[model samples]
Structure formats: C-alpha cells, structure tokens
Target: MYDEKRACPRVVFHAEARLAGADQFFDGSMEDLSRRGIFVATAQELAVNDVVRITVLNTPILDLEAKVVRCTDRGIGLQFDGALYN
Candidate 1:
C-alpha cells in the first residue's frame, strides 16, 4: 500500500471536542493537531467535507471552524479554514 504524505505539522494531545450543530456531546482523544487541522476519534460518525465547529479542551474560548477531510468508522480528520485564523 502506498503511504499518504502529510504537508502540515501535527501535535498529539488528549483533548475533548464537540461537533457543531449537534446537541449530543462526544468524548474523544485528539490524535493530532496543528494550526490548520486536527484529527480526533469519537463514537459518532461525521461526514467528510462537512463544516464543523470544534472547541478544544482547556481552550474553551477558542472555537475552531473546520472542514472534514476524512472520516472513518471511529473518527474524523478535519482541515481548518485558513480564513478563520486570519
């Protein structure tokens, strides 16, 4: 199998996140994170390319808007909108 190449920086951390537009909250650990993206594993399934708002643990005041890049049976990979950070 061919390995996918990543262009962004990734940092691992244990964090709590919630999906936007959904009232139900999920407890998941952050697999990786960067200023431009994040990867998280949760029980709920999220659609790829879906726009979502996520709040990281200990950073409640900073809600991030991101687009789903990949979705698996257990988790989601999100790409943050560059415009949101500027």
Candidate 2:
C-alpha cells in the first residue's frame, strides 16, 4: 500500500515543463499537481534543490517557480515556492 504524504490534494495529469534559466525543456507526463508541489514524470537530468520555472500547459498553473526536492530515473519531485490558484 502507498501512503499519501502530501499536505494538499493532487490531480493526476500530463503536462509540459520548461526549465527556467536554462535552454532545456521536455514533456512531463504523469504529473501530479497540487498547491504545495508537483511530481513530473520525465527522464530529464536534474539535481536536487535546483530552482526552475514550471509551466503546466492546459492547466491553471503556469510560470511557477519550484525547487527540485527529489530526482530519480523516472522523474522529479518539485516543491513550489508559493500558492497556485488562478
């Protein structure tokens, strides 16, 4: 069984993520969106604690500054800087 350790509810959706301040981008599928953070399923090479702009296309969240908290071969987990609502 998987335990939910999230503070906010998350919605499962696939979206594109653009790395801010870098000339790199990729399609982030199997994304879990929430007010606190998001997990994007991508093989993009990234390090922990790296701040990047996350633009969730086809969703309300866009141009959001987030820090990479977790990075694995499957994807990355980002903790957003602020609230996401629009």
Candidate 3:
C-alpha cells in the first residue's frame, strides 16, 4: 500500500501550464493541485532539485517558483517555494 504523506490535500485541477528552467522550456498541464505543490503532466525531461518557474496560462494568477521533487514516466511533481494562496 502506498502512503499518503502530503501535508495538504490535493484537488483535481486541470490547467494549461508552462515550465521555465535554465535554458529549458516545457509546455505541460497540471493534473492536480495543492497549497504546497502540483503535479504536471509533460513529456519534457526534468531532473530532481531543478528550479523552475511555473505559469498557469489564461489565469489571473502570477508566476510561481517551484522545485522538482519527484519525476516519473507520466509526469513531474513540484513543490512550491511557498504556499499558494488567494
């Protein structure tokens, strides 16, 4: 059984997303969102501990800074530098 170790609950949220890293850019979509992090579905390659700027397209939200925490064949998991608040 897998353990749910997340500090915050995640909600199903689909949104077009852009990831910007040093000399790297990826177009992806967010599958789930939480106050502390998000999971982005993308084929683009990224490494753990990489810093990236995230922008949710067509939204009023400002750009967010995050760090890559987990990577899988399906997507990458990111932890925001700060909690996402309204």
Candidate 4:
C-alpha cells in the first residue's frame, strides 16, 4: 500500500524518536520514513493535526516540527518539511 498524502515513497525504518508538545512528551520510535513524513510508534494519544517537535535521539536533526496527519491504535503519522534524522 502507498501513502496518498506522501511526497515520496515510505521505507521501513527503526529509529529512536521523541515527540514533545508544549505541555506533553512522548517517547517512541519511528517505524517508517518518507521524504516528507514518518510513522511514529507512540503509545500516548495525540490529536490529529497537532504539531510536535521530533527529536531522533543523538542525531543531528533536532527538534523538527511535524504535523500529525493520522493517529491510529499503533501510532501516529507525522508530516514534516524535511528528512527524517539518520
């Protein structure tokens, strides 16, 4: 299956991810990655379209802003402007 809202194809990836809001924080991992977005495996519930800063632990891309696109039982889909931290 392909993501219709994605600009690039998604790839299966495994990376540490942290989502931080103004008053909340979630610790999770990035389950997959695309050019413009990623699927963050977070257990905590986040509202759709909510903006969050993503920090890939120990990576260069710190505090990347992303909009929540989809929130499922497993995780949340994030749309960002740039690449996912490698």
Best lDDT among the predictions, by candidate number: 3
lDDT of candidate 4 over 1-86, digit per residue (tens) = 95477557788888897889779988988977887898998788988889999888868876788999999999999999566554
TM-score to true structure, per model = 0.73, 0.72, 0.88, 0.80
Candidate with the larger lDDT of 2 and 4: 4
- Candidate 3 lDDT over residue span 29-64, tens digit each: 897899999999999889999999998999998699
Candidate 3 residue pairs that clash: none
* Model 4 residue 10 CA deviation in Å: 0.7
The candidate that achieves the highest TM-score relative to the unseen native structure: 3
Off by over 4 Å in 2: 1-5, 21-23, 58-61
Q: Residue by residue across 1-86, what tens digits does model 1's lDDT show?
A: 95647665566767777667345555566777776788889767777877877777777487777888998887888888883343
Candidate 1 achieves a global lDDT of: 0.73
- Which pairs of residues collide in candidate 1? none
Q: List the residue pairs that clash in candidate 4.
A: none
Candidate 3 worst ten-residue window by lDDT: 2-11
What lDDT score belongs to each candidate, Candidate 1 first?
0.73, 0.77, 0.92, 0.84
lDDT for model 3 comes to: 0.92
Compare candidates 1 and 4 on lDDT and give the better one: 4
- The TM-score of predicted model 4 comes to 0.80
